[model samples]
Target chain A: MQSELHNGINVDIQEYADLIEESPSFQDEQYAALVTSAQNLVSAARSARVTSYGSEEGNGHMGLCFYFPTQTDLDSTIGDAYADLGLSQASPIWANYVNSSTRTTNND
Target chain B: MNLVLATTILLFLTITILFGCSEDRVTRTGIEPEADNQTWGVLIYAAGNYEGDQLSGPSMSSSRAVATVRVMETELNSPQTMTQACLATPAAQGEVGIYDVEFSPRQPVGLLNSELVANLGSVSTGDPQTLRMFLETSLSQMHADHYVLCLAGDGHGWQGMMGDYNNELGMLIDKLREEIESVSYLLPGGKFDILALYARNMGTIENVYELRNTADLVLTSTFNVEQPHHKIIAEWYRDLQSQPELNRDELAAYMIDAERLAQDTSEAVFFTTLWNTNTMNDVAAAFDTHSAQTGLRPAQLRLRLC
Candidate 1:
């Protein structure tokens, strides 16, 4: 994940990839625990500044980003690099999503 | 008439002055004692040639590297703290220097009076060997109970961090972990107490997980980290000096507070994360399981524009 200007790249892909994984059986308790843990993490992150910008001055900064490529990104050089990563090979979650997006764009 | 009284008073004053000037009496000569074990040793590796032409004057003229050193000099003051910085700047021949930095009480704040300990003639800052060499030399020479290693430069996320413009090289993420691991044994707990990444967009799972074993705590940002904001690190040092018993978690929290507070609305997009290397394994496992259950769905994959 990269910023708008491409100066910075987000590296928190593991958590995002896990979030994409779905089970046959719904585990409410487990999901609740995950949510609680995520909330605790967010709470621990105390900011001194009243406001932090993401895209613009007023826009808030999102802490994490996952690899979910669109049709345009899939057709670009970045898509090739993304495909080459070990995570892409090990986990088909992101790859499947990218393929679906590409098919949707092609169909449109 | 009172010659005996005057002589006795002069003699007493002379004796007091002599005792005050005793070698045991501590004075702020600003020079650190030789071979003394320090409470903390801060090792800073800054790739200073981030901007400007290589053939021109040095790139550290007003770079973040020099600013970090200045912050350390002014804010980091502890008799038990030893600070060293290895700066890689683009000179006529691409100069790299190791400096022993200390706060000079004699001079006003904001002005650094650092000592150049050694000059490494033309070395690639992007090389893992160079980083390992610096770590080895600094850790072996500067004996400390705890160490904080600060890596400052531009980051390439998981690919690597730090760009050596002169040599046109970048240190790979895996290589970085290997370099630090090589010197981890010399550390008190077989790892650095804190690994502070003073680069932009290095708060990735790939890099952090790879380096989890090398440090107890990892301080980095998922987005662009304002280099000037790193002055909070010097403040953290000051706090650490005042409270030597502050644990790693507490210190990490303190840093988070300091960094967040240091930011203002004037700054654009500030986000930093303090990863506890101890629990990284749990995070990885839990997330892995969750990913397996959910799998990949187009409907679930929401595109975040930001």
Candidate 2:
């Protein structure tokens, strides 16, 4: 999911945003603590997918996706992260995409 | 009488120095000298010097150059029309000699200095100037009407030709533009025809931006070049060598066909090609990949998982 064309990590920014909300006090400058926790979960998901071939219930939801409460939620969460990081506001910002494969997709 | 002799001596010295300078003269324009006949030039700059401990680990670039030159010699009928420049290792610790490769059955594949040879030096491949010199020598001396500059070495996609070697692809393209500009002057229109990158990770979109103006056509790969990659390309060239007249696009297409066929045979980590040219502008081409994972949304990326 990492690319030179785009900026930042490939995982969903909203997941990190949700985790950051959980922490009462503000963490490090760039929300390092929140990102670290989110990244570890992503790593676990990726590791699990390595052996997750036969475990599929065949529901056809193995492909990952990101859903928002609203499109505004998507824009607010992803756009704010982009502004904070000073990354290119171009097409290939994959962090905004729901390009995950390691975990099952749901309306979480 | 003494003044006349001294003047004559000075004139002689000046002539000799100028002539010597001309012999070593490098054209920085990066332009191709125009020729009436169709001539093909392939320059393979193989930087095998691996900095530290990796030097001892299975280095085959020198042999790979030998193999490619051998193929060219064997398959190609018109030796005079085709020219190849190979820069490779086994000379010194951090340097490589750029050899003028001709199809000589009597001689070895890469003989250092022969009647057919041009220049000799253990030039550092890590230096950007050295890379420019190699290209300059090819365009100025070979005098090919049409050129196919092949980068046959280690490469990192966006970072460029050689990250460890110090030149980035972007800067290399910047340097090459001057040469391309020089070549463009001779022709009715555009610059030197094709740039074939036989190294690793050179077919990405990141590379396309750097290479847009440097070459008319680029033959590059998304994956790290495998052991069998060069041999497959050689085989393709051997087959195409029979065809007397094939334009730039046809030639590149043939190479891509061979690449796709070769990708089928090997279990590579990743394999994709970007057949980029002036004609195929801004279009993203997808690859036919094989994978074991049974993700229902196969297109989204099952190949990455497996």
Candidate 3:
């Protein structure tokens, strides 16, 4: 089971490294090694069994969480704060996607 | 006469330079002479009033803060102790106090049981300056070989934490990073040994990246933090007392092992993970690259995972 998890993490790491390779700034062996380490940590976290509220089967808690908010939440003051985050500011594509989604959600 | 005048001017300039460069020139030294340097000092910036109604009773947030202090008190060995924990929280009517966590066997006593070491007059926990002051005062007075800063309050991942309605302030992640960095600048090591987030949803890459330079290791939860982890920390405290030289990696591994043990013993699922902040920059950059390439909206990614 551990080997299988390790394999899955390697695949994810390779895919992540490939994406970074496309970016000119991060095209280095050091970046690849760091990505591998992070993915391994994330995989170890996801392999752990999490249980919430006395139920062992339905705990949805993952090892590493990302900022994914509902459209309403994204439109609120909290969303304003989220948009101002360094990550959001760094990734214009992500920011644009969020902005477009908010627009689409509002139109709907 | 000219020679005597030159000599006297040189002597006056030397005295002026000595006084100007003296430590006594700085007001509010933020140090306590009575505080003995210990192996580990844990400072908890606990804001209790952020979660529940102030009129009814102690909020769940405040209750958790009290429970955490109690757990520390139970594990702390007095008279020959190498671990010192302090609780800094808002008291009645806009008053904030940093209390010394002492070993007390009395039943049902809350934060009042601890000794009031420093009273920070009329400050909101939501303010970044308040956090800086708390850290500066505690770091100077606690006097530890290493330090673990525990932020115990309500959190919404990267949005904010430790909100104060009275002061109308919210402590954003950026402000938190700056506050910790400023305090670290004053420390000998220039960073905290460990930064433990007792709040929820703080394990996100962005939040961790923001705090990368503040601590060697960041201990936080991806979801709600379990109460059992407090006991895990207390256990680590006991281990620290025995070893007194546990490195950051060793301490992180020990806490992770304790979490795994807690999970094995019961149905409670814990999402606590420790990340080396040194590696967070590359992780965050890689994540940004992946996000840009995928062109997936944050919500859509969540939906796809679900």
Q: What's the i-RMS of each model?
A: 8.3, 16.6, 7.5
lDDT values for all models: 0.60, 0.44, 0.59
Off by over 4 Å in 3: A1-5, A8-62, A73-77, A89-92, A96-108, B1-36, B52-62, B78-94, B107-112, B164-170, B225-229, B260-265, B303-306
Tens digit of per-residue lDDT, candidate 1, span B1-306: 599999999999999889876423223325536338877788999776666212123322355666566667666546677888887764324677777776653443322477777777787787787788788878878888888898987776666676777544367666788899999789998999888887776765446656778998888766754445445666676687677567666667777776655555465465666767766555444334434444335334332222
Worst 10 residues of 1 chain B by lDDT: B52-61
Cα lDDT of model 3 by residue, A8-37, tens digit = 432233434344456566646655454454
Comparing 1 and 3 on DockQ, the stronger one: 3
TM per candidate: 0.67, 0.52, 0.68
Per-residue alpha-carbon lDDT of model 1 for A18-106, expressed as tens digits? Answer: 45345544465555454443433333222211222233432333333333455575666445544544444334554454544444234
| Order of models, best lDDT first | 1, 3, 2
Question: What is the CAPRI rating of model 1's predicted complex?
Answer: incorrect
Error of 3 at B295 (Å): 3.0
Q: What is the number of residue pairs that collide in model 2?
A: 8
DockQ comparisons of all candidates to the true complex? 0.12, 0.03, 0.14
Model 2, C-alpha of B136: deviation from truth (Å): 2.2
In model 2, which runs have C-alpha deviations exceeding 4 angstroms? Answer: A1-108, B1-36, B51-62, B91-95, B106-116, B143-145, B163-188, B225-229, B260-266, B279-306
Residue-by-residue lDDT tens digits, candidate 2, B187-214: 3245557776766656543354345566
Q: How large a fraction of the reference contact set does each model reproduce?
A: 0.09, 0.00, 0.23
**Model 3: CAPRI class:** incorrect
lDDT score, candidate 1, position B237: 65
